[model samples]
Target: MLFLAEKRGQGQVLPPNTGDTCSNVTMLDSRPFSVLSTSVKSEIRKALAPDILAFAKATGISREDGFDLDKVRLDALQIPVNNKKNKLYIVHWGDMLFGVNGAIWIVEVNSHKGRNLIAPDEGRNRGRSFSGWGMQTLSSENGSYPELMFASKGYYAGGGAKADAQCVRKVGAFYKINTCPAGCDDNLNSR
Candidate 1:
């Protein structure tokens, strides 16, 4: 497990980051409310609002279609990669309505690189129908980048209900999906 140092010299314990690859998969638990100040959280949310709206639009949902920015749930974690000076943000946001849509954004502020894990078009099937999805992070051995698991549940083509999981890791400048159980291919083209 890695620990983050607080301003007062106290250590804040984070989830364990071990192994060459992500394993010991489990359902994602509720994240801590937030370690950031209220103003900082508001700023982050404001910065991401446009992207969220764009996603909804791409999924054929409009502002009048029950898409409310205020109703979205956002969770963020600030992680120090190489040192305390350099940091990365793991942000996850989901709609409060049935968890119909959600995404994970990994941002490296120092590097000016941001990766959106799920594409808007891929989020919904036909402009309205969508799967309920969630994400979990597993710290990598290097402790610089964490492996991610995206799990989703939805109906099958034949009307049968199904659930799926996929594992993703940062390779060079992009995130790639590793072969796993059924339904992992849903977000194959996502960045």
Candidate 2:
């Protein structure tokens, strides 16, 4: 195969080595994926805007289909990971901030690697107490965000601090961004 294809100048050509059959062979496809268009990128960023309800209502997107991707909002709110790791995500109904004042829908996550709101890091924030939401920069290069403020239910059972969990749900805002920077060409073949 190497000898026949090289003669046609289809790719890199190699000379036959003495008594070596696989000398000029390698196993890997050197193709790049289609990058997302700037417009799509912008849309993705816009979709993840802390004010998703406003955009959804404004865009006439009422609800999402269980498996239909068209119903999912695309955006760029992704956690930084290895270059080969997948960045795409599916927004769950529970994972969304839905309400009029969407600001109180989230709690704050302050970690060096930042926090994935959907999947809170328990190792770092276990039993660590936070005073309150005085105020701070709600956003950064990571895009706009919502604070996942915490509060104790103030109840106990069997002397153990039995606490109930609930979001502020006041002015809470955030959009679920489901997308790929490398545009959707799932087959991954260049046209």
Candidate 3:
């Protein structure tokens, strides 16, 4: 549901995003959502197991390890303050989202494995282009955190702007977690 909306393009799907091999990446488009039978969708989801497993195997480890599925406590999945102030991660076992720069692939950010497991760096800056306490504060206020924020910066340890562009170009996913801790304060953000 989330990917579809984000992949629709613009900054999320940034320029120089793809190589010639792959076509445009799409998510949450108007088309895929509409269906006559909810049951059919359910069945399709069920049917996806084998292919998903194959994908996992084809890549290397099984999907179970890659996604960190067991760690996910859907209830406890309250987006953690990994660093950034505002954005939140829609994580399961790992950070999973679709992408396409050369060839589209379902990318996952795994804290379980160090750096080898996830996508190789796109060779951009080690940190974000935008800096300043205000940006960091806004990010925290919004519950958005960089996927692998590094500590080199004052606040954020790992996420960034190019990271976002790269992410969108790689896979049209945008951060979509409501980071406010359920009722303490909902009216803080300026977004």
lDDT, candidate 2, 1-191, per-residue tens: 12311222112222222222112221111111113334433443333343444445544556552333233432121222222322221111211332211121122222111122332222122211121111111122233332222222233555653322222111322233222123212211111
lDDT of 1 by residue, 43-149 (tens): 55665576777667767777787778766666555544554543455565554533644565554443233334334333343221223254445556435666666
How close to the true structure is residue 6 of candidate 3, measured as C-alpha lDDT? 33
Stretches of model 2 off by over 4 angstroms after superposition? 1-69, 88-97, 100-191
For candidate 1, give the lDDT of residue 140.
62
- Give the whole-model CA lDDT for all candidates, comma-separated: 0.49, 0.25, 0.23
Of candidate 1, the 10-residue stretch with the lowest lDDT total is 20-29
> What order do you get sorting by TM-score, best first?
1, 3, 2
Q: After superposition, how far is residue 180 of candidate 3 from its true place, in Å?
A: 48
lDDT (tens digit, per residue) of candidate 3 on 38-77 = 3322332333333334444555665456454222211101
**Where is model 3 more than 4 Å wrong at Cα?**
1-38, 63-98, 101-191
Each model's TM-score? 0.54, 0.17, 0.21
Winner on TM-score (2 vs 3): 3
RMSD of 2: 23.1
Model 1 segments beyond 4 Å from truth? 1-13, 17-29, 32-35, 38-43, 59-71, 78-80, 97-101, 110-133, 139-143, 154-162, 180-191
